[model samples]
Target: MTLLEVSDLRAGYGDLQILNGIDLSVNDGEYVTIIGPNGAGKSTLMDSIFGLTDHKGGTVSYDGEDITGLDTEECIRRGMNYVPQDDSIFPTLSVMENLKMGAYTESELSDEKLQDIYSRFPILEERTAQVAETMSGGQRQMLAIGRALISEPDLLILDEPSSGLAPHLVDELFDKIDEINADGTAILIVEQNAEEILNRADRGYLLTEGKMQREEGAEAMLADEEIRQEFLAG
Candidate 1:
């Protein structure tokens, strides 16, 4: 049951090639992470999938259909959502209001769904009306994630959810991620926190120099000394 399948994806801005024939796949309800060094095209991969970049060549299959270059709105309509690493939320809007924006296309706004999100992130319900600008880094991350969840996407592409947060906050964030996965939405994550993300993931791909070098189970790969020294310490 493959929800998302990317084969030989080549994309870039203008003439600058970022993702070089990248191939990846995510099964239903799988927690997959792509760990890579900066400038290794992690962000570019997400951008290409969400149709935010110029994709020169590739096949992006979502739920058995090709969505190689669908616009953002179209992709969202296809049950695919993206939460980038930065500037994903409206700074001036209240948290609850931001969520309302996420549900703009939905005809029915259910408390049951909102309560489900709030249960996973208690902090969000506590600060539901607070302006997004005033939230802490960790809280902001939580809000960004919550906003995306409002769509109840079948697949959520998160680019570095653990960026710029304290150590403890990362753990809490991953716990929430696990909760989301438990509810049956597949997750595709790109995180710079090698040890942290890999430990929590079900599978991981090591992308470097714009190429995937290795693929393995999250915990098993985390225990590999060479991988730790290369990506974690580098």
Candidate 2:
């Protein structure tokens, strides 16, 4: 079943349009990745779904409910979480504090959820009292992802989770993402590292100039000579 559905989405910031008549969906526990060249509006599609953009048209439905035009908080209340490419964590806050803040909307944080997050990212457990600002880039990303998972969202939307990380750390980060999806949270990621994401995703979409140019299974896209030559830099 489709957990999140976006149809003919058209959105932008203020008067400038970014996505044009785009359609996308994520089924329960599915791993979906969107990849394209710079300025292809990959992030804009995520922003639209999360209600961070000026939605000009289209319907966004989550878990069989229409969420079009809903505010960010309402989207979160409905079991959706977003981790942007940059500035996702509170710099001055300690690791534990950042995770605690993630559950602020709820009545209280449960120990079970906290323990789950720590298990998924063991480094976070060791650095619970460390300041977020002092951590390495990869550690900060892990904390951001861990904080988002504290809510136990049904769908976790990530924009460029691998961006700006050292090459070796990128694989480690993807491993964490794979573990998260294995535990049954659907993932929708917009990534610049196309080949790595395509290798791991169940499905992949290629966007160009604000529109979806192709949609296919990850392996098929990887094997297509045309796609590899044009987009994957074969």
Give the 10-residue window scoring lowest on summed lDDT in candidate 1.
Answer: 101-110
Q: Write out the backbone clash pairs for model 2.
A: none
lDDT of each: 0.88, 0.93
In candidate 2 the C-alpha lDDT for residue 186 amounts to: 98
lDDT tens digits by residue: candidate 1, 1-234: 999999999999999988888899999999999987889999999999988888889889999999999998888889989999976899999989888878876876589878977888889899989999999999999888888888889999999888888888888888888888888999999987778777777999988887888888998788888888888783
All candidates' TM-scores?
A: 0.95, 0.98
Q: Candidate 1: deviation at residue 169, Å?
A: 1.2
Off by over 4 Å in 2: none
Q: Give RMSD (Å) of candidate 2 vs. truth.
A: 0.8
Please name the candidate that would achieve the greatest lDDT relative to the true structure: 2
Q: Against the hidden true structure, what lDDT does model 1 obtain?
A: 0.88
